[model samples]
Target: MTIETDRLRDLVAAELGRARDRTTLLTESVDEGDLIRQHSPLMSPLVWDLAHVGNQEELWLVRDVGGREPVRRDIDELYDAFKHPRRDRPQLPLLGPGEARRYVATVRDKALDVLSRSRLDGTPLVDQGFAFGMIVQHEQQHDETMLATHQLRTGAPVLEAPPPPAPAVPVTGEALIPAGPFTMGTSTEPWALDNERPAHQVIVPAFHIDRALVTNGQYAAFIDDGGYDDPRWWSEAGWAHRQSAGLVAPQHWSRDGDGWASTSFGRTQRIVADEPVVHVCFHEAAAYAAWAGKRLPTEAEWEKAARLDPATGRSRRFPWGDDPPAAEHANLGQRHLRPAPAGAYPMGVSPWGVHQLIGDVWEWTSTDFHGYPGFAPFPYREYSEVFFGPEYKVLRGGSFGTDRSACRGTFRNWDYPIRRQIFSGFRCARDA
Candidate 1:
């Protein structure tokens, strides 16, 4: 289906608006001190994220695609993510929240002007609003980062969204994904990131994956069985990290009387047993899998369960179908501050009846972050190419913090094995 110039422009504009709205919502509630404070060394300050969002938009949309002069040219180095490390961001001469907001607003105005006049076809960057889409996705990605910063910030709750609907009925057992070759990734998704490009065929052996994400209640059982205490379940490196960090349970979790409570945003509440476990690093997930006599699904296995429709023998844009995400489809776009109960969103299940494959928590896969057979970086190499190695592990699907534009079956998320501050989780898979 060819996208017309007007439709493409509208889509770009709408996505840009949504990205800005989410960014504002995430940052505006906090005071200036909160915005400038470095909540965690691993993350940039909120104000830095705020300005960086605009700086990136300006780079891709106004400067690169529009072929226009730079606005606030000198600040480029200050906001250059690759140039400056997260820990050093607090020492830079950063823009205040008011100035940062104005800068982004000005950049957005100019970008929209470019969108209105520029042709949507010619080069890969301009075709299908690729640059525009990239900018929107970049901003949304920062929005997610800001949300993570909020999670790390020590203060009263500054964000809130109503809980998602309860599951109609719990999906009690694993779903059997048939053994076969299915199309993985995509060569056709217009807005797909570079890593998810060039669709390919993958043959997965028969396997049983959980119908829903592993719940807090289930993980608590692992804890009760001394999953963390015993070194047998953890890898050598994982055990070392666990001991060094003194990790007792998932980050932000603690014993509240006889039960457990978790801190979200800033409020501490009793752990919801039915909800998918969040904040567990790859090690924890791997350990939990070991405790249960299961294993983390390979990236290919996760993609097959998510995108491949056995009947059609093709990969859909999302798990449910080729439709954009809806409220009932998944918990995404910061619509909820927490993951809904596992087994919810039956409508979001894949063709093979794998539930909640698209949202709730980004499920960790037992695969290293690597490129495909025909992998080639477009626009820039730093986005995905720089990080393809054994140092990072792959994560599939999206979490509650993910924007719909950035969430898809083929979208690849990876991180160092030890990092767990993001909204990450896992499910167990076993051979059939």
Candidate 2:
């Protein structure tokens, strides 16, 4: 094997290990009761996620890539996510906490062995280690989901992380992205999901987008001005959901004297004025944009702001550049429990001076989930093809809980428009 091949293998192995560390942290933070319990109808039991990741790794790496025999063929059906829904997972026969831990550990041991000898440049699946990258991303994505379950679980705070750094510079207002064409997707990103493939040109007219995300204090103004109660500020569907759900503020927020407080991971704290507001659904974000005399950027517009480099007339791999994320770049990889104050991570800003565009929150966009112009599902259709429709809205960037292995400039995330349980927020944009 060449030196380059050795380095690539080492990098892939390190990423896999990083994802497992996070998964362990999320699953081991609580007792067996917490792991077995389904905290919300919207999420699966922690144990389900714990075992599902291992099942996927076994299917993709141990069996498919390495040509090894099945580790636990019987449990494949039990962990098939589409075969069972989140609300019904707790009722199904699932591995206990200890059993799940042992199962995943065994799978990881075998997977690492496969990595030690597998060719890194043969078929497309093995070339550049795409299959291994996919498995690492799958596990990290589930780690994020498990973290959300912890938030919904009823108990004392079981997670801990240091606060994000204070803002390094005062940030306010918006930045103008000059009207032009920029690449919107990636044909070259080895691990990019199918939906973000077939890099294509997107022409966006001149627009103004918030330099920073909508802060808690900014969102509070919308609530104060009857943003939720006024149907005029909401879409027909948003207003209907607002009424039916009886939403008065962003999820986890409550009235506190003349201010507001929010509970996170079982700990309640006074709302910080400059911190980005989170736990908001797409409807809430759109309505808030309307109330502010702006609108949520279309998916194209959001991508232009995040990836386009004005000087070079090209799109980079991240807001900052093609380099992988670092601690000083964005608040990702569950390194922090909450978003940093606006204006933090000056080094993370896009070429257009858009702050916090790549992390802290999954910024909602106006576009529905869809395939790129020349999209084709690589290995399976269930990953992206099944979800391409109006039923799911596109969310760009990532969030504090997102892992770097699963995120990039072209990465796309989608969910029901009414979902607020996930770590989500938005920045308003306007035509210039």
Q: What lDDT score belongs to each candidate, Candidate 1 first?
A: 0.90, 0.93
On TM-score, the candidate that comes out on top is 2
**Residue pairs with backbone atoms closer than 3 Å in model 1 (clashes):** none
Candidate 2 yields a Cα-based lDDT of 0.93
lDDT of 2 at 144: 91
For candidate 2, the per-residue lDDT at 203 reads 82
- Candidate 1 lDDT by residue in tens digits, 200-290: 8888999999888999999999998899999999999999999999988999999999879999988999999999999999999999999
TM-score of each: 0.98, 0.99
Q: Could you tell me how far off, in angstroms, the CA of residue 360 lies in candidate 1 after the best superposition?
A: 0.7
lDDT, model 2, position 83: 95
Error of 2 at 87 (Å): 0.3
After superposition, candidate 2 runs with Cα above 4 Å error: none
